[model samples]
Target: MVIRYSFDSLQPRPIDLPTEVPLDDEADLSVLDEAKILAAPASRADVERWRDQIERWREEARSRLCYSGAQYDRIESQWAQTCFAVAQVWLWDELLYSFEDHVFTPQKFLADARQRLGGLDAVVLWHAYPVIGLDDRNQWDYYRQIPGLKELIAQFHAAGVRVGVDYNPWDTQTRRGKADVEELAALVADLGADAVFLDTLKTAEPELVEALERAKPGIVLEGESRVLLARIEDHGASWAQFFADSPVPGVLKSHFFERRHMLHHVRRWHRDHSEEIQSAWVNGVGLMMWEVVFGVWVGWNKRDRSTAARMLTLQRSLSHFLLEGQFTPLVECADNADDKLVFGSSWKRGTDTLYALVNRSEIPITLKPIREETGIVQLDLMTGAVAQHLAITIPARGIAAVMTSQGEINPDMIELASEVSAIELSDDARFEHRRVHRVHESSRSKNTGESGVLIEPGEYVLTVRYRGRETGMYDGAPYVDEWKPLVPRLHDPRTLERVTTLDNPVIVAQHEVTNDEFLHFVRESGYQPAVSNRFLLHVKDGVNGRGHEPVCFVSLEDARAYCEWVGGRLPTEDEWQIAGDKQGFQRLEPHVWNWTESEYSDGRSRFAILKGGSDAQYDESEWYFDAGVRPPDFSAKLLLMGLGMSRSERIGFRVAFDRRNK
Candidate 1:
């Protein structure tokens, strides 16, 4: 019982590579160097111009906040109107407070005029303190004294404004390990508070998270402070705090005053512990700012409010940035000791990457060079300055955003290939005793036997090779067979029913498309792969020797996209079968199981396609060790060739095409 396979019928259309351009002998390398030198100054100017152009582009790109330009404009206009309304109320409240003659609490004034102001994302309650010890004191006393606190909460909730309470954890109220912490939390929850702030609890104990969850299931929890308690715990600090009897010289420097200091502190906290912060945020906790009042104070009294305003604006901007979606931090850089000269944070949004950098120190920091074509936009968080390419010097305590457009690269352009060579098996009586045999020039010619069905009609570069032990007769072969043989069967020959199977024999490349190769495809096609569609694939033995390499995680859709881009199509299961030969007995060599064009179980499950031999090892004898064994008498062999296998990490492909009448 033997079956034959063919590769010719499965041929696919071939893509032509670009012709090489010949260089002239007169083209002097030194002249090129001289030209580079001459263009150096001009290049600098060009770079600056390019930066400006990029900035302009970024501004244009952000003209429409999200993707739609018109929708972005509408949203922007609405946001402005809303902000203006809020600003008007804020201005009115400030004036009334200044006059000291207005008879209204902050809560009441904001509440009564809520309808006039457009809906806000969130409503911030400024002065609600928390209850501390069973015996009221400080903020706890204030909380107990305010008869209108509960009413304020109800009013805000009714207005669809999620109320956030501002309470310092160390203020003898919300602090964990305190006598009445649980009681205060319970009371706050009962009052219908949407969220509670534990100011200065940068690293609220894990138990505290559990306690809060238990007290108010699903309630948003937030930690407010710049000390970076969790980060500091993870990465130790080595400085002692000492209070000077006399005031330190630069303690209140004009440049260091106001929210700039706060910004610096916040940047440091985020930079040092971005991962932990992101984790906490995703795990039912929100990050908050308490010293927004500092911005107002700086703006009102300091005459020089630019820095303070920038800081406040950046903080608000970051709040929205971090809360956009779930993210994992990739890189972070910050100065822990000085807390001043630090800044940098980045996250992956879908397929796009977004990054932000802040200049906390008075001196400007030239950031490390970034690739020009990564499609990053530098946004001035404070002024809404957007630039496609950015190299501007941020003013002291300034912030800039770099966002990469999502889904710009085409997944079809990504090309992946395996390093390991394919092998071919044979079914001749001479090779019966030895299941695996190395394919050489002579062997390939001898086993040309017959071609398989042409799965599709076009062009293909198919190379056949084989794997076997190094013997005196087969010297100078490519691969060496290292695995040992299995024991001979003991059952009666007549009683056994022979089961036939065909393994897809073409070995596809290993996991993942390389950065360089992906870049080339993008350059040629101007196509961007959707970030959401791209994935990392993983394989066990596919790594072969390089286990640390990037994994290739792709879907059948991704595979189809690549084939279409390269003028090919996926192979049908029958077509894949026709490419490999069946040897005697149930054993098939070289040809691993290949994916079929047909959907599994009638497409109910997309993953029904067969994969080759178990990459998973069975035993040391057959897969690992190779002790000597004699050849058998009546065995059979077949062309053993490597076949592509679909794996989360292995990047392999099959031939395909549109069916044509023949």
Candidate 2:
């Protein structure tokens, strides 16, 4: 049997490119709305035909669907049009949550967003998934259990950044809850979420739509990728993930169909975002900034971040033109030659017209926009100043905008120019890399009792094996700069030969610590976690009969505390691997994964390495964390979270004692 990458289903579906065949007037035009990009005809003679055909299709589709677009006109849903830059923030991102303080720091997150991505118009508090199913806690519990999440949302609202909560329809295996629609509606109402991001669904079922609307009138529903044509009426926005564009720059189908329907272009794993930024600018849509993808760091390059900042500044200021103006895709610049790599779009409303341009080449190119009327004030959007000359030079792989208005320019445009004038266009597009470093356990224990197996200190070469999940074993992004990573390269069983040097002798516990052992430690030491939301949650349900079972529902910190109380420390991943290689290292009955002291952080994301697979595994999907018992060399990366959420019923820990000076 051939195992394919598509089996993992990690990547989005292939983009639907435009058809080159000419369409008859009677052709069903509704099918055209499914295209990722409405490509321009290559021949000049067919340009008019291509444009007319699309217009006719839109008219026909609208008539057939009875499209009123009342959703866009709603005063409540109006925010969707202006929400240009939304950050898909991991709930536990370092900037958002302080692990040390055990608190959610919305101010820090907001400040960073403003500085780097030119201020986010909204943020999707991405919870669950890539970490869910570790235990029975459902998706809603992840959000509702947070201590100050409501206050956090309030802070974001105060900063003018709307909050969006994610809805994962795939979470059917976890602890049962109300119907997804009812739970999602209640969650939205409770948190005052401005939008609900359909994680994997292109559109929510009609039942969900109605429920959410009743929960929060004017609530926006944003689908994951391409939303169906008919569903676009209610879906205020859609995520343009992995959308491949045409060479001549094409129009976004959904945006073209309804100008107010926002589509945020995003390629999560790609470091260089020039293509997405350019697409968003030309289409007058939005961009989704997912710096920390799940638990991996796929941060935006400085060049792209600056480009987004500049693009958004103008987009926000002259949004009136972008939203209400008559739009023309691939407008011809006055001095643009056929050979030039620059492309631009023109948005015209009354006497004012705004031109958004992008240079696809590696060198700056100057272009002159057609001056149809005399005495028009040309404001250089890049510099936020008046254009000294008609010829505007766009930096290599950069974006620019020019607002040409009759008489006086709008105060918003002038303010936008002033805001962006201070921003220096960055030429550096280098990927900002962060290496994941293992955090060594600071608290060590002296070797005393020989209750466990003793391993003589020596360097050992171990063959480590793991399933290549998207969360990456220990460090770096699993897929970088790849359009889409498929099977063989994704979610396949992988092997690595690692030579680990252990200078000091140590004794690794033969079996994981039992529930009774941890209970005694907690009772004797009276250890109380600072933010004890889910600490030792199983204890409340009764750990009495499970005294001999491996202790579960304890975080790495909690495990470390227990091990320290026993005058021992949690073994490092290498130490445990070596011990596992030696016979007699037993897994407790009803096996649970052991937490190694291999916590790592790349600043933005923090994760820990787990060894010795557990019996509890959710085998229904590849997106779930690695499961089933395995060899000592097998390892899994668990993204660490604060507020005791890391504590799981499927995970436990053992101890290692360092040999004291003899």
- Index of the highest-lDDT prediction: 2
Off by over 4 Å in 1: 1-104, 107-141, 155-182, 198-215, 220-343, 360-369, 374-391, 406-662
Decoy 2 TM-score against native: 0.95
- What local lDDT score does residue 499 receive in model 2, on the 0 to 100 scale? 90
lDDT of each: 0.30, 0.83
What overall lDDT, based on C-alpha atoms, would model 2 receive against the true structure?
0.83
* Candidate 2 wrongly placed segments (more than 4 Å): 1-28, 384-389, 408-412, 487-489, 540-543
TM-score of each: 0.29, 0.95
On residues 604-662, what C-alpha lDDT tens digit does candidate 1 reach at each position?
00122333322222122221211111121111111110011122222233434433334
Steric clash pairs (candidate 2): 5-487
RMSD for each of the candidates: 33.2, 2.4
- Positional deviation of 23 in candidate 1, in angstroms? 48
